[model samples]
Target: MATAPGHPIDVHTWSTPNGWKIPVMLEECGLPYRVVPVNIGRNEQMAPDFLALSPNNKIPAIVDPDGPGGAPIAVFESGAILQYLGRKTGCLYPADERARVAVDEWLFWQVGGLGPMLGQAHHFRIYAEEKIPYAIARFTDEARRLYGVLDRRLADREHVAGDYSIADVAILTWAKYHEKQGVDLGPLPHVRRWLDGVLARPAVQRGLAAI
Candidate 1:
C-alpha cells in the first residue's frame, strides 16, 4: 500500500542492514511509509536538511507526522527507530516484558558489539585499499569473537530469544555478511540455524531490497 500525502512516516536511510531493520519491520507489519535514501557514500548526511533531522548526520532517521501527539517525531538511532515502529504497530517488539527485554538485550549486543566490530573489519579489510594488517586483524578477530558469543547464545534457541522479535530483525541482515568474509559457520551450528529462521521471514527479504 502507498503512503498517503502527509503519510504517517518518512524514513531516511541507505540500503544498509542498520538501514533495513526498520523498513523490513514496517513492510512486515504492512505499515504505509515513505523511503528517502541517504547516500552516505556521497556525504549526503552532511547536508543541512538531513542534519536537521539527524544531527549526527546518520542514515535511518525517521519523521512520524502521526506520532503520539500528532507532531512530527524525528528519531535518529536505528534501535530507537525500531522501538518507535514497534510501539506504533504493536508488532516486532514483543508485548511481554521479560521477552521484550531479552530481545532488547540482543539488540544492544549487536548494536554495541557485532555491528561496530564487523564495520571496522570491513573498513580495513575491504574498503581501505591499504593492507593495514593491524587494523584488519583487530577488527576481523573481534568480529569472529563476537560471532562466537552469538553462536553460543543461540545454542538452544531457534531465534535470538523466545520469539522472533526486534532482536532478530535488528541483527539478521548484517550477520548475513559473515559468510562472504570467509568467516566460518561450522562452529556456529546454532547461529546458522537461527540465521536460517531469520532468513525465512518475508519481512527480512523485503527489508533487504534496495529501496
Candidate 2:
C-alpha cells in the first residue's frame, strides 16, 4: 500500500545499521517519512506504546498510515520492513518471480547470517565487558567467512542480486562495519568495491546523515 498524502510514514528508529535501513529505503523510493527516535541506549524500546508497534522491541519499526485496504499498519523487523517498502513503491524490488527469488535469498542471508554474525562479532570484540577470546574469535571468523561469501557473489555482478535490490541495501548496512567486525577489506577486494559504490549513493548518504 502507498503512504497517504501529508501523512508520512512514521519510522521508529535509532542510529544503528538496522535503523539506517528504513530511512535509506524511504529516501530511495522518494517516500515521505519522519524519524521517531527510539533511543535504544536508554531502553526506550521497552516502552509499552513502542512494544505495541514492535513486539520484538527492535529499533527500526514503521507505522504506515496508508496500509493494505487503506488501513494503518505497523511493521517490525528490518528484513520485513525492507520487503514491505519495496513492494509498496515497486522501486528496488523486482516483480519477476525468479529475480525476486534471487533478491530474497540474499536478503534472508543478511538477516539470518551476515547481520547476526557481524553483530555478535561487534558485541564480543567491542561491546562486551568481559571479552572472551573464544567468543571474539568465533564471531570474527564467521564475519570474515560471510564477507568472503559476499566477495565471491560480487565477483561477476555489480549488486548482491540481479540488481540493486533490497538485498544490497540490507547487506550494505552490515558490511560497512567490517572494521568493527574485525575484518580487513584488504583481502576482500570485491566487497570493498561494492561497498564503495553503494556508499556513494546520494540517498544512502542522506539517510545515514538523517540519524
Candidate 3:
C-alpha cells in the first residue's frame, strides 16, 4: 500500500542496531519515510541540526511532518519511536491494556537490559582499546544469561511478548549480532528458532535492508 501524500517522515539514522529500529518500525507500519543518514563514526550526530532533533545526539531519531494535532514533531530514542509508530498506526501495539503491558515488559527488557548488557559485551570483547579480562567475562556472561532468558521465553511462543510486536523488532537487531558478543546460539535452540522465524518476515527483510 502506498503511503499517503505529503512529506515523508524523516528518519535520521546510521547502520546499527538502535538505528535499524525506527526504519524497521516505519516499514512494518507501512508509513512513508526517508532516511537521512547520520554517520556516527564521523560525529555527524553532533551536528547542530541533528542535535536539534535528538538532544541526546543519538542515531535513529525521527521527524514526523504529519504528527499529533497535524503539527510536525521530532522523536528521539528507538524504543520511544517504536511505541509512537505503533500507537500512531494501531498495528503491532495492542490496544488492550493487558496485552499492551506484556508487550511493554519485553520492550523495556530489550531497551533496558538486553541491549545494554550486550552492548557492553560487544565493547569489551570486540571494540575495546585495552580489553580487560574481567569486563569481557562479566559482559559476555551476562549476554549468555540474557540469551538464556530469551531462549526460555520462546520455548512456547513463536515471538517475544506473546506476538511479533515491537518487542521482537527491538530485540532482533541486537540479537542478530550474537557472534560479535562472544555468544553461541547452539545451546539456545529456541532463540535460534525465533530468530529464524523473525528474519524470514518480508517486512523485516525490507527493514533490515533499509540501511
Q: Compute the lDDT for candidate 3.
A: 0.90
TM-score of each prediction: 0.92, 0.97, 0.96
lDDT by residue (tens digit), candidate 3, 97-186 = 999999999999999999999999989998899989999999999999999999999999888887689999999999999999988999
lDDT of 1 by residue, 1-211 (tens): 2343446478899987788877887777777778888988898989999999999887889988888877668999888888888887788788889988898899888888888778787778888978888888888888889889888888887778777788888888788888644478888888888887788777677667737
Q: How many backbone clashes are present in model 2?
A: 0
What is the full ranking by TM-score, best candidate first? 2, 3, 1
Clashing pairs in 2: none
**RMSD in Å for all candidates:** 2.0, 2.1, 1.4
State which candidate, 1 or 3, has the greater TM-score: 3
Q: How many residue pairs in model 3 have overlapping backbones?
A: 0
CA-lDDT, candidates in order: 0.81, 0.91, 0.90
Write down the worst ten-residue block by lDDT for model 1.
1-10
lDDT of 2 by residue, 1-211 (tens): 1243557999999999899999888888888898999999999999999999999898899999988889999999999999998998898999999999999999999999898899999999999999899999999999999999999999999998988989988988888889999999999899999999999998888888877
Task: Tell me how candidate 2 scores on lDDT.
Answer: 0.91
Better of 2 and 3 by lDDT: 2
In angstroms, the error of model 2 at 70 is 1.2
